[model samples]
Target: MSKAIDHLMKVHRPKQKIQNNRLRSVIVSIYLTKFVPCGDPANANGGRWLLTFGSPDMKLDDLWQETLLGMIGDCFSHDSDPQPLSRFITGCVVSIRVRGHKMGLWLSEAQNPNIVREIGRRWKSMMNLPSTIRIQFETHNESGSAQQKPIYEE
Candidate 1:
C-alpha cells in the first residue's frame, strides 16, 4: 500500500478510546474480511500475523511505528540471509482492546517456525522488548475459527 493510502487507513485513536482499549467491532470486521483468508494451513498459511501485546506504559501508535519501522528497515538491511523470510512481512496492525494494546506483523506463511521466530526476534528488538515477551503466530484458519487456538507462539 502507498503511504497516502496507509496514512488514510491508519487508525488515529483518541485518548478516551485508547483508555477504553477495546478492539472495536469495525476493526475486527476489517481483519476478518480483508486480511485473514479462508482455508488450510498449507494452502492458506501463505500468510501469518505475528501478534505482540504491548506494555501498558506504551501507546499503541508508538509501538506500531517502532515495529513497522523495524520491519521496513529489515526489508532493506544489507547483511542479510541468502534466503530471507522477512520478505513475507506484508504489513502491520496496531490494535487496542479492553485487555491491552497489540501490534501484529502480517507475514506470508505460518508453517515455518524459523521464519516465524526470526520475525518475532526482529519485532522484539525493534520494540525494545525482552526475550521473554510473548509473540503469537495465528494463521487465517485459526484466526477465522471461533474454537481453534492460535497456531504457535515465541
Candidate 2:
C-alpha cells in the first residue's frame, strides 16, 4: 500500500513550469521608500518627502523605478501616457535613510515627484496586498504641501 501511494504521488507531481508560476505568484512583503522634493530650501533645495510602502511579489529595485516614474509622470510633461520616464527613472542615484541598509538611487528633479498624492495612490495599488496597506508621503514642510507631514514615524 505504501509503495502504491508513493507511485501515485510521483505520477501526480506537477511540471517545472507550473511550479515556477506558483512560486512567482507567492506573496512577498517588501519595504519600499520613495523620495520627492517638497520645494523647500531649508528642508532641502527642492520640495520633497519620503513615502514608504509595503509591496508583495514585486522586486524592490523595479518597484523603486516604477514609483519614481509614476510620480514624475504625474508632475512633469511626458510624451505619452505610459511616458518615457519609465526607462529613465531606472539607473538614477537613490539615497536610502534606513539604518544598516545603504540602498536607493538618487533621481533628479526630472525624476522625483512634484505631486506627492499621485505617487502615494499609485504606490498603494502597486503593493497589491490583500489587506489595507498604509502608504505615507512625508515631506518637511509646515503647510501648503500636497499631502500632510507624517506624524508617526515608521
TM-scores for every predicted model: 0.64, 0.32
Model 2 / residue 76 / CA error / Å: 10
lDDT of 2: 0.34
Against the correct fold, how does model 2 do in TM-score?
Answer: 0.32
Q: What is the C-alpha lDDT of each candidate?
A: 0.56, 0.34
At residue 5, candidate 1 shows an lDDT of 41
> Residue 142 of candidate 2: its Cα lDDT?
36
Residue 49, candidate 2: alpha-carbon lDDT: 28
Badly placed stretches (over 4 Å) of model 2 are: 1-49, 52-58, 72-94, 97-119, 127-132, 142-154
> Which digits, one per residue and each the tens of the lDDT, describe model 1 over residues 45-96?
6545455455566555565656555564554233666566556665666555
Residues forming the 10-long window of minimal summed lDDT in candidate 2: 97-106
Q: Which has the greatest lDDT?
A: 1
The alpha-carbon lDDT assigned to residue 104 of candidate 1 equals 69
lDDT of each residue in 3-115, candidate 2, tens digit only? 63454334311223235565332222112134333332322422222333333232444544444444444333245545533332222222332221112222222224533
TM-score of 1: 0.64
RMSD (CA, Å), each prediction:
5.0, 15.7
